[model samples]
Target: MPSTTAISVRNVSKKFRLFASPKERLMEALHPFRKQYHREFWALRDVSFEVGRGETVGILGRNGSGKSTLLQIICSVMRATQGEAHVNGRISALLELGAGFNPEFTGRDNVILNGAIMGFSRKEMLRKLSEIEAFADIGEFFDQPVKTYSSGMFVRVAFAAAIHVDPDILVVDEALAVGDARFQRKCLLQIEKIRTSGAAVIFVSHSLETITSLCSRAIILENGIILADGEPKIVAEQYLAILFSESKGEPNLDITNERVVGSSANQGIQINQLRDEQFCDVDPSAWAGSLSERFGYNRHEVRTTNGCAMILDYLVAGNGCDDISGVWSGNAIAILVKVHFSADVNQPIIGFELKTDKGVTIAGSNTFLAKTQLQPAARGDTKIYRIEFNTPLNEGDYFVDLGVAEYDGSPGGYVLDVRRSMMHLMIRRKQEKPFFNGIVDIGFRFTEVDC
Candidate 1:
């Protein structure tokens, strides 16, 4: 019978001893009866989670948050100082670049070596060697020593080897970030295949978008403890809130129950009001031009700073209409932003970005980039900014992120308030156009030359 759980981590904790000096280490080894010369540092404190068959769980945290340490423990590369972790199936982990390969050994030899470590016989390794080589796509480097390989080449081989072995649990620790965009997409597809095969995956990445798109669930780790676990969207928001708080030297906000608010701004706009009210009238051309457009609102905002400035609300609507659910490709749309200033600011800048559902930014513009200058603003002032442009996106779901910052005679100066995933926009196929090839559909003239 097959195991129901792919991974089980129970109250796992890892502790490392910190020695003051080299002499302290020797002193402690020489005299066991004396007081210990080292202090204990806990990297993980009772971190507990489980992954079942066919489930993918994303691990997210800032640096020094024990994400890597936890992955190492799960892969059995390091043992926990307390508690226990059990793996029900064979594991293939890509924890670090060139972690398992011997520098002196050729890629071919390393492949066989890794397979042996995974309990495959020599014949079985040879049978799968061709498939691994083709997947890696490293031409002559397969026969050369791994030490001679670049970082990208090294990861290509390591990733190919790990996935080809058909492990029950896959643990990828930010390894895909090193690969090029094309390779990353290929790897994501392969991960999807593995998931389809009923294998559990534990993915650790700093890209919240990746976590949100790929994993059914996500957990946020902070200072070696599990801070939040549930939907990827909620967890990512909590993580961002904590990051913003830390950057501003404020107390960490509980994002679950409370909204992040500025210190001075009380009796501000309510969430429902922001959603229901029309900040501005839509352009006439936007609604009059397209009859196939639909529009709805799904917005989320996080105040990164105190009450210096606030983005009250924003809207993406078709021409001449305040309400929109979706828009056709190549149609005209307008973005309106309402901002309130509580403190005097010099050279305020506002911007917007349109990103694909996969979190890849396709196009965006800001005031600084456009060389637009605005007058300085004082407290209790409100301003409305509008940007109208034709949509260049293909048929797909996209997100709108808005930000407000103050220019300090520098590029991308101090950010005041930023909102991510503020609204979801869907782009549909236009009747006159063919299928677009990439994230954007740039209508260009075409010509062909006969050879």
Candidate 2:
């Protein structure tokens, strides 16, 4: 049996008129008379891709790289300036929250309207209304006008409606970022259910984790062009590499450099080995971990019943034994990460990325897939997550990258904790053998025991 093709977008492109003067737009519209539009802004340039039934595909790009424009065109919320798009079934879109909503109408009213536009009948809407309400969790406020609702409520209701409509094709654009943690996970689970139910999906998101976890394939977009389209990890890694490569040339000059000031510094008293180590070890405490590359831009912004807590004090230690940062090239080492949790977080996973002195991500790993959190940690709670690996890194200065998240099998729901630049480790070459292949010598093993 062959899979059905659900969507086809051929050479789709969109262009907008840019006017140097505000009057130019007015003048051009009034034309019978010609106008003075200075330039044309091509939001999308001949972008073409196809989606198969039951397949989830991700479109990734920078802030203004046409991902949204492509989605809007395919979902029929907007028309293409050139080329054509074809969809084989009823389409549901979460392109923008409250997009087709009438603010004057109550949330309950718009829920039915949006579902009806999605091809659901009033009876069908009523049938799924409970499911939508359960997902939204907005309470009696559902009877209030949507315009008065919060951003969170708007997205919750919108996502509930989109999924409840049961369209044959679903187009989701970063709507996962809309609500709180529990809801985000709930949304991802629903998306998974939808995909499994045979609805073709076109998902656009910056969260590579989400893309890789939910979609069978991923595509990268740059400057309104398809940069790469292939496996999720390969595409996500490439995106991260390019993102850091861009971070190297110009360290956001305008952005204030927020240092991980040790607890002692803040408390006005030098306590804990961390403050002491910072003074002695030129590298900060954040770099105390053996693998730091995994944590690059790995910060999580976690919200709990109490509040939010930023995970800090990442310490990586090797078998060199004592210091979390202590490790010599060619020696057995254990990578350890210590994080301070501010609130109760369930199933928090920790990992690291190893970066060379030049900001190249060498290798990284997290317990997310391999293992699960042993316990839920609360405010002022600290835990150590450790991974042991044979010494494989070259002798050089390297940065440690860290990440923390409530492990939901899908990637989009991660609440970034912290991406700090404090931890730095120096590996001294093994005395007898200084052979360096690249960043790490991933020791491959071969055992010759009789079977």
Candidate 3:
């Protein structure tokens, strides 16, 4: 049976009148003939989606992509110009900073006031007050006016109050990103608890990892319309690909033209052909004439000094042996790295590292780590190395840094060629399985012990 729908939005659109000045606003309102003094701006257009009970849905988009406007409409903080949103149960929302709290009021007072707004009586709020305080962990700031609180503190108190009220639907709008790492982890745990308790969650964030780790489904918004909606990983990848294209001053890749490469007879040869196409596209000599010319330096971020070998190209291929723009968690994928030798070298090593946008290394591997030996390469020779495995990663944008070096018979080695931000990888959760909490999805097994 299909899950019960807890939130439904139908053909929802919002339009605001942009007045040049206060006089224009007043004139427009007073004009009996309804003379237009303001231009109309549509924040949302024909957007529709449903969130089932116990489901977590992520909204991904660029800034001003109508994400916040859609959230405000769903929370009823703002009304839609057309269409309707039907919410089945009480909602607790942490929208913009200081959204439900008065800046002049003490945090304690705001908690009680917000609780009352959520339909809890004063006594009932008092019963939950200590739990809220403990969760917020603001210490003496709890007694201070909200105006004195930091952005992080504001999020803490707001999140603590919203979650403590026992809402059937939770709407969070990039608020958790304000908190510190430890607190963010705590909030994620609480969100998981809420999901377990059957409360639907609507999360909006620029952080793809957070979205893919928490939400089972995701939607991508562009120009006030639903661009894509389905698996969190795919939607996130579409958003990133748009970003990548725009960064290079090119039009977004037409994902509609792409199809999943299916497994068939002669899959290996078909995959090899696809890989060849990928490699040819990234060839340095072809950079001036290839399709990559339109996307100048889309994959070129090289860093090397006194280098003897250089990475000529690389490819990220999906299960069907086709180059993929994005990949999903637990899906089989492959990375092919091709290197060109400029000088003879002994004990040459090739490796790759996956890093977050913040430059934190999540995982990496080198040929030395794998204890693999390869025949020495001479000048004018090229070799290809491939690694294939199932990716156990959370959804987010990641960078692949490729490097080639010669082992110096110790832990330290001489770097030959290294490229930072050489390739962009997007990983999204494909299943509605429980959210994984970390960067990697290490499938851990447990065994019972009896004494």
Candidate 1 whole-model C-alpha lDDT, 0 to 1: 0.76
Per-residue lDDT of model 3, residues 1-451, tens digit only: 1448889999999998899999999998999999999999998999998999999999988788899999999999999999999899989999998797999999999999999999999999999999999999999999999999999999999999999999999999998888999999999899989988999999998887788778899998887998788877556656665665424322343522244346432121212232245464434575333223221124445577476887766666775544555566677777877788889988888778878766899878788888887778888777878876667887666677888888888542678888787666666554465567777878766799998
Write one digit per residue (lDDT tens) for candidate 2, span 366-442: 76665544577776676666666565677555666656766676642365464534455545454566465677777
Q: Residue 426 of model 1: what lDDT?
A: 57
Write one digit per residue (lDDT tens) for candidate 1, span 365-451. Answer: 888988988788788777878877788777656777888889987767688888776666656554568865787776777799899
The lowest-lDDT stretch of 10 consecutive residues in candidate 1 is: 264-273
TM-score, each model? 0.64, 0.58, 0.69
- In candidate 2 the C-alpha lDDT for residue 118 amounts to 71
Work out how many backbone clashes candidate 1 has: 11
Which ranges of candidate 2 are over 4 A from the true structure?
1-3, 30-35, 247-451
Error of 1 at 20 (Å): 3.6
Which is the winner by TM-score between candidate 1 and candidate 2?
A: 1
- Which residue pairs clash within candidate 3? 233-428
